[model samples]
Target: MPKQIRIGTGAGYSGDRIVPAVKLAEFGDLDYLVFECLAERTIALAQQRKLSDPSKGYDPLLEKRMRKILGPCAENKTRIITNMGAANPEAAYAKVVELIEEMDLAHQKVGLVTGDDILEYLEAEDFPLSKGREKILANRDKIISANAYLGAEPIIRLLKEKADIIITGRSCDSSLFLAPMMFGFEMKEDEIERIGKGIAVAHLMECGAQVTGGYFADPGYKDVSGLADLGFPIAEVNVNGDAVITKLSDSGGEVSLRTVKEQLLYEVHDPANYITADGIADFTKIRLEEIGKNRVKVSGGGGKTQPNELKVSIGFNNGFIGEAQISYGGEGAEKRAKLAAQILMERLRILNLKFEGLRFDFIGAGSLWPGGSPSHIPKEIRLRVVGRTKTRHDAEGLCNEVEALYTNGPAGGGGVSRKVKENIAIVSSFIPREKVIPQTKTLEVENGSG
Candidate 1:
């Protein structure tokens, strides 16, 4: 008889801060533990790792945690997958080997999937990282990061090798667990519709209790309950591929209708046509419920066909940026910040540099206050100017030049200079699955390696 495979994920503030997810494997009958980390900036950091060090990229802290978790999982025989591989899977894989050895786990095979960091490799292939290549703006040399988000198929393939843990580079968040489920249940590709629906299910529940009551209305706690030990969500997916989102019995956070709705709206723009590499899921069909305090069940979640294209994220040389700040202590400080930015913009035009972009913002005065029109007023205001240039030096120059405004131009204002970092390249494309490979190869590592 086939075992009923269970899937769970660690949830956090932004999908990256999933400290609670580290404990998810301790729950009931978990066949696979999937950790989804990385966003636009993460890809850029991974690419930089490759350029700076060929054997760098994956997060070391995550590796350490995996080592600790694997001890118990290896005892129970659970497989794991994560995109923590970043730019350099070889280095990451070696670290995993070190951890496994420290735990003295026997017969633990760790599989690494690479080829996700193709930024440098693409340049070598004369690919030059063009924008809209496969419909994604492949940010060329200016790219801060480049990572290929792999789907679940490759992971499923790794499971066939009897690997205890699978490490990957930028695999889809849903693919982390869905791949294992597919492998365990022997799901097929022809069932693309079902596969797409499963991906949607994973997305809905990936943030753990977030879909339940964490983000929902919890008048009792004001927001989420048990703020300290909030539990992540798990899916008990059946052979038919249907999933139930739940958490450990003694975990934190609440799974309520409000939380589920918040999770549903996460990064979802088109409710009718949300596509993943696996399949397409319809947002309209999602039926959520508060089955228990920390349990939210989903049903009737199936949708239309997915587009042939895949969304690619690309980062490129957008250029360097410089920022300066000024605080308005006097009344009408909010008005001052806005005027200061406008004045600085004019000054730059006179200087003929004009800056690539410039922005003035208000802080503390509730610039973030909801509603197009602010309903309430606050005390004090901060006026800040940020400008970006094509080059780092140019940006620095602007920062220095702006500070001069305090003495020569604006009143009751002071300025400071700060450096900024490159975000990431988000490119969308439609590449046939055949064109991409999961890089399901492993490198042998010595005992107690770095």
Candidate 2:
């Protein structure tokens, strides 16, 4: 039988937060650490990185964290897997290998699973990942960023080699720890459902303290003590993969049924089916018990048939969008903002310049001037108008026209600043599992002498 495993994750991770996770892992004595650093904006950042340097795809912060954690884990005999390689995992691993050598860490090997990014193949045949986002893709010929979410099997393969650390692009967040458990226990295929339970455990802990009173808290933990040093949640998983969610010893946070329930609802659209790269998990049948203080016992969960269509994120050139705010004073201030936005869009329409989208909103007025909520507080209102077009020139044109709304028509137009924020196009695309099959290859690395 394999030894009982403990997995912990730091507070919600971005490119900038991976460092702290590594530092925590160094001192926490965890068997495995999983890091999530990819977001919608992360893809954009990766694309933007390519413009200045070819080796600029992965988040440098993630790389730095790996550098901090890699040697320490190997010394302590712990393993780690993280999805910090947003666009390029192999390249990121190469950087890690370079760091290991530079730091003079002996016998340290890093493995990376690639072929997850389908950008090149998807870009072929002029399938420009920008077709749908005309407004953000103005004049851009192709998508600035594209990455596919990979599953856990590849990471399992890497761990088999005792590589010490594994990195890759978008992956089912739960898979990071699941791969370690599966490899460590030599679990069989028939037991995968129980593994699914462990995956759920990982999901709850993936966002760090999220499942431990970060977002959901009882009266006792309402203030969220030790927020700056709030330790990550841990999963004490068994050979069968059943687990309890808790935090490491001496950690600050609370984990209970309510906390687990709070995390179950995070980023979920339906309680019956939550999709992941590995499989689908149903939170509806989940049973939670307040096993102990800062601990929750989970069981009686269910899952569904995994979807055949893999969700692919593709960002292409969406033309451009610009908005300005105008403040109004007095009784009808809120109404003025709304009307101002509408009139600005209408005026742009009269100019005969086609735009992909437009939106107008009032800052404050009778709970948006229709459904008046109780406790009305007098507040200044702002009218804002946004426009998107296929060409930057056209987008700028809309910006120019909307800015003119202040002097030409409605009063109280104030923050009319025409500034270009992001220049590339953004497009979202989805590829069926069949089309993505080609990019799902895995490699094996041997760890110790056989």
Each model's total of backbone clashes: 30, 21
TM-score of each: 0.84, 0.79
In model 2, where do residues sit more than 4 Å from their true spots?
Answer: 11-23, 67-75, 122-146, 217-223, 226-229, 248-253, 269-272, 302-309, 326-332, 335-343, 346-353, 365-377, 397-450
Give per-residue CA lDDT, model 2, range 83-172, as digits (tens).
777776666776776676666665665778776677666657344332353542343455666666666677877777666767778776
Q: What is the lDDT of candidate 1?
A: 0.65
Candidate topping lDDT: 2
Q: Against the true structure, whose TM-score is highest? A: 1
- Tell me the spans in candidate 1 whose CA falls farther than 4 Å from its real position: 1-3, 11-15, 27-29, 118-147, 212-222, 303-307, 335-343, 346-354, 364-377, 401-417, 442-450
RMSD of each: 4.0, 5.3
